[model samples]
Target: MSAAARAHNPMPVLAGAVLVVMAAQQAIVPVLAPLARDLELPEWSLGLLMTSAAVMFTLTSSPWGRAVDRVGHRTVLLSGLSLGLVGMTGFAIVCQLAVSGVISGELGMALMIGTRSLLFGVAMGAVPTAAMAWVAANTSTTQERVKGLAQIGAVQGLAQALGPASGFVLAFAGFLGPVWAAPAVIAFALVAVAVLLPKGPSRRARAAAAAEAEQAEAAAPSKPLRPWDPRLWPVMLGGFGSFLTLGLVVVCVGFVVQDRLGYEGADAVRMTGLVSTVVGLVMVTMQAFVVPRLGWPPWRMLRSGIPLVALGAAGLMVADTLVLVTACMAVLAVGMGTVGPGYVSAPTLLVGPAEQGRVAGLVQTVTGSTFMIGPLGGSALYGINDWLPFAVGTGICVAGAIFVWTRKGPGETATAPAPQPELAPDPS
Candidate 1:
């Protein structure tokens, strides 16, 4: 079907799915320490749950994207949802079993790593890969691509905000209530997607996309852009530094509240929730309402966002009070809100449309690698000293800022940014 004939923008549906998936994933942040204690496992081991997922995503995302390019988004996305449902449900069951002493702590942790982390990780990777590839394939200009990718960033912030709120509310039922609810919500989304989502990219749309790529590549034929391509490296480093810095702070935020602020268990969770909500709200507002209006180029956005991120990191190092921490997190959120669209969409601008799937996978792979290193690394750093993680993070952000400002990545700076369009396209 033509873009004009289409009844809905599938992007919004896809974004909604991401929002749910992320909300479920992030809900565990508030409960990680408590759950670890309850299960008689070392608290640091739980970070493995996240690290495992990141490892799987880093390994599998490229294959997943290639599948989307070969077949279509519907299959890959549905499969992701199905895998996530099964995996997350199994995860909740194991958590319940361990809580009841039906399984040993070691055994429970192992099973959860399998069901929740490893399996779920692979599932999570598929969502953004397909969604971004779909977005990159459809949009013809950099601004359009950034606007589309910013939707992904906005939902992630919304999820970050929502995750802890869900945890706080669900804690009334039981500690496990939020965990159990994740699959149910995911299942509902899966069915909605299976029915409402279009079958795949249509042949006509594909041809139009290819024709567009040809026009864009008239000076030189498009080749599959590799991660190591010199043209892509500056973009990669900027993305890597931003996420790595983020990882250093994110995995430690809850613990900081618990230890430094002398809040225990639910209080710590609530405090952490407040911080996450503040940051999430900031990110959501900035990406959704502000970024599009400004319509800055990807390079410019990256350049502008980095110093703010560094300052946020520096602020986090000194933030002892709950108010101070929340302010620092909001600062970080604003910087990331600026950085994410540029980081995510810049690669699409560097290559022709034919390589959108590959480039999208590469983009996610870089981010996923940070997820692997960030959680475990942050946890370990927090174990040593509360401020060390943020200090390190501050350094990385500064370095990223330096690189982004000094380096000239080809294609991104060469073309003037296209004029901003409507907030979003009306696919209806």
Candidate 2:
């Protein structure tokens, strides 16, 4: 990799943009239930905020990917952050209204859901779609794809480390402090993206890549990558199950720590943040340091990880101490760190450059589907009993992992596949 290639590669700025998006969303998680209680909302309302956004994320993913294909990465990145800033500001206003008694709990929840989840979900969806598409379009081999997707997981892992801690710190200013300040952070990220994200691939470079993709499509007879496609469904199932388990756990963590360990109010929020920090750090260490060196194949990552996840969840069901609980959380994060890159990389190896953006969107859709329903389910089950959600969620992970372990690699087609489209050299 040379300076020129490095100059054109999108991952670095793309990474910063991704960090901002993930951090901002996750920052709200730990305090969400407490804030809802203060505003006199029921337990189910807690999931509504994320669920609404997730629903939109799932619904709009394919279109967002096509928008990137239509408009180019730089344009979409700029616009997405810009919209996110607006949504963030509007969300803050809605929360302030509820906190100050200007709006009723139900109305404020509805307003916040529309403002934050719906608009924000649509806006933030673009960055990851561009990222996955870029990685898919650029990498030719399974090893390279795994490394690239691992890079993504590592960035997200870092965000997870920071986001919860920041929220905990910000909560000192008041419950609404993180909410009010998020827009400014997004505004700053938007500026950085404008300054740092590249204009586009050079005209000649774009023309050559386009021509090569056209040639490959003509030869392969292009079909739009489908979520239900036979070659891809196994990977999708693995991702959906693992992440759904994540959704279940995350939404319940603050409650679990608070109830099981006898923490309350701000202490619960802080303890939840502590649990998040442990998980985040572990994921970062695994994704950044351990994964690239192990050189394991994607399915191995899937099979190896899901069982760990099940074990972790099982521990959570029985563990009474905060220390034990945090240990379980750490084990679960390890599982996430392992499965994530595999889930991200495997499908790209099964397709051509032509389908990268669509695949990216579908991957995002898989993640989105979890948040859409998982949060509400987790919260509801927890309300019934602390351990019930984990029991059910662990069961799901076991089922999904077994499915992956029993099946052969989808990338191992019956016949050797067509050559990958030639891509530009990566940046140094």
Candidate 3:
């Protein structure tokens, strides 16, 4: 196909590849309990596994973003997928060892942390950074950028719904079945990416582009951006607040179902699953359908979403029945769906193309950090009082809303220059 055609429509291939990888990652959720039981590990050990992965993900993202800028998206993406495949295979082997009494429970858990958590976390960071960088590079207009990024998030939402169900069903095949399935899924994604993604800019073309960017930077020099840079503060703050809220809800919801709603064991698990599915579907619907049609700028979306999140958290604080809780959670989902794409796209608009990868990485890093902080913080507050977390989350969301409202929207561009000297020219 022609370059124009590829540029015009890379989403299908990118979205498909991302969906597969994300599904493979999320599939672990359903099998966590079963794996813990079979391996004779404590349930809380699973939480530690997840937390370790999040830490790796957070630490690696910025570097991976820099790699995407240096090596090109396809190379980084393929490498990440390969790492994920190896990681998943290793994790499956560890599980099989535990089941067969070939390894002690402590050793098995250690192997899981090394493979599934650490290795897979690095892959998670690489894939999303590459995907977002690809979108930012391919899409010319602001609206197109929003649509492309939103579609990525929509696919993730779909995967969040599909992965657990598929994993649960596959578990009937045996202890190793679901564990092994993740590598197979990633292998498919790797092949799809290799075949479908167009050979992006050639080495010479990238060199020329880089040289041009260098000249532009020389003409108007600017300082490097820090994590706490003023231009980036709003986007980072908004993302941290949004994901913190999400993390709190995700961790606490099951507890709330069991403790507050008088459900227990299998019933509580089923209810939590049902609620999660509904939230995922609502998020997918909003990002895929509602966002594209709204045609609102990123700033406007942020302004609108933050307040809704605050309101939803407040509702969840008072909700007693399952139906009421579901409604409140749905509200939170909508708010999250709206804010996510905007938080991603807005920073790209303010800078030049050269810095897209770095910005994408920084954004992912902030998000990862929140997931790490949110769950532990929420769990602690919930232990104190169920209402405390929600009340605090509501306050956080409201503060985010106020900050975003007072700032300039997407129409207002910041003076931050794209990363120029730091990014090596792409060489195929």
| Winner by TM-score | 2
Residue pairs that clash (backbone atoms under 3 angstroms), model 1? none
User: Model 2 over residues 1-428: C-alpha lDDT tens digits?
Assistant: 23443557768888888888888887777777777767877666777777788887777666765665545677777888988898989999988888889989899999888889888988767776666566765676655665676677677789899988888788778767677768888998899988977777565665665666556557663566667898789889888899989888778777777667887766677777778888989888887888778977788889989998888888899888889999999999899889887787787777665675467667776778888888888888888888988999899999987798788867444233335455543311
Q: Encode model 1's per-residue lDDT on 1-428: one tens digit a residue.
A: 22532445687779888888889887766777666767666646866877888899789887886677556677888999999999899999998998899999999999999998888888888887777766765665556666777677677778988987887677667777778988998899899889988764466665554554446446344465566887688888887888888887887887778767777766666667677778878888887888779978888888988888899999988888998988888898899989887887687677654455467667877888898998888777777778988999999999888888787755356564434222212111
Pairs of residues at least 3 apart in sequence or in different chains that clash in candidate 3? none
Please give the TM-score that candidate 3 achieves against the real structure: 0.77
Count clashing residue pairs per candidate. 0, 2, 0
Model 2, CA-based lDDT: 0.78
Report, for every candidate in turn, its global Cα lDDT versus the true structure: 0.77, 0.78, 0.74
Q: What is the Å distance of residue 327 in model 2 from its true position? A: 1.4
- Which is better, 2 or 3, measured by TM-score? 2
RMSD, candidate 3, Å:
4.8
Instruction: Count residue pairs with overlapping backbones in model 2.
Output: 2
Best model number under lDDT: 2
